[model samples]
Target: MRLSRPLRALVVVDGTDLHHDLLGASSALRDIVLEGGVVADRAVGADRFVDPLPVTAEADVYVLYRSSTHLAPEQQAALSAAVAAGKGLVVLHSSNLFGFEEGGIDADQVAYELVGSRYVSHGDAGSEGTYTVRVRGGHPVTAHMADFVIEDEYYVIECRDDVTVLADRTTPEGGTQPIVYVREHGEGRVVYVALGHDMRAWGSPHFRQVVRQAVLWAGGVGLDAVASWSTRFPLGNGRFIGPDGGAPA
Candidate 1:
């Protein structure tokens, strides 16, 4: 199945300020193929990744690099414009910086609310400790993730009145943190992953899977979605054992 028009994806790894190799993110994303099929668009999404609007309309996928700048005008404009163009966008950590600065909440609202919480701040290494990422079920993006540990900046994402929270991690207070989330912006769809401070995180298979799914989902791909590694999903252990109470493999 082909994507409807106005759903091409462009992945922008805007690390121009952080001083890291954009090549890895560029290359890894370049390797992703939709539904096991290669395309002229997604393959070259990296090269097409630009700083601002040379990019037409919204891409089915837009991976913006997170930096220290607090929601600069150009950044916000590009993002808003992408949605106006009717596309799907995925923002990594620090990308949230642009939305919020060192201030209180606002009427405009930037912190994404997917489920019912907010992604406020990062977790402290000493008190907040790192841990593994356990998959709740058979989500294509998360199932492949081995419970890995990383002491990254956790968040307090305010659950918007609208949206869905995909994954949640626990915090020092034993409260659940909204890690991955999705919502609609205009006619377009937007998803945010509250991690990826650097390239290493950017390259995780699980991370990549979330991104791929967000791309397809934003492009109007249905619940029966299929990515390269997601032939099996919605993995509920929905089965009865044999005569005896045994596991079903």
Candidate 2:
């Protein structure tokens, strides 16, 4: 039952953090995944802990973009089960950051195993600047994207050894780190992106293209259609809630 391209996707976001404005992120992700032609189901805040995890089980792909490091065993197993059932997974920026986990389970270990990486550290916050982002090689997820300069939060990703590196970003300190990658787990596929810490990255045309292609590719959709779609359609205007606490108009 391998998931094919343009499959249904379920997004689980952590809504507890008022500062992160995960609600805006959730809305943006829904639109973005939909724009890529995938059926997107929005699961905001605590709804992700629904009993039996019906939404995840029914979907072909699971997307997580939140900062909540706490996951009950049942919640963790549900996601694992989805992947084992041959579904796809797309892990975004904050999903890799497991800070001060409260549960007995090692949150960092769980993230790495599920997403093929975890965020160990990062540069200054709100420090947006132009950086060199390059397509490392000929990976399907990085296809149709080129090396360009973007202004956003640059993350330093620490991924597993076997994960396929797709693209990289040069840090302000002259160090290069993996920004995008994918890995295969059991019968499922996983794509992780360390970019998109804020609205700028989410709104960037190039960033959206890379993420759209990654979502499709991770879902087992052939790249030919995604590449063609990339050329025909522009990215959705996903809203980004800034740190100033004002929502975008």
The numbered model that scores best in TM-score is: 2
- Tens-place lDDT per residue, model 2, 1-249, is 122433888877863565466877788878777777778888865345445367766777777887775655566666666676688888888776553566432744554577787666667543456786777646667765667667766576567788988888766667778878888888999998877767777787667767777778777887666544542234333332122232332
Score candidate 2 by TM-score against the native: 0.82
TM-score of each: 0.64, 0.82
Q: Rate the local accuracy (lDDT) of all candidates.
A: 0.50, 0.69
RMSD of 2: 7.1
Off by over 4 Å in 1: 1-7, 19-23, 32-55, 99-119, 126-130, 134-153, 156-159, 227-249
Off by over 4 Å in 2: 1-6, 45-54, 102-108, 124-127, 235-249
Alpha-carbon lDDT of model 1: 0.50
Number of clashes in model 2? 1
Worst 10 residues of 1 by lDDT: 232-241
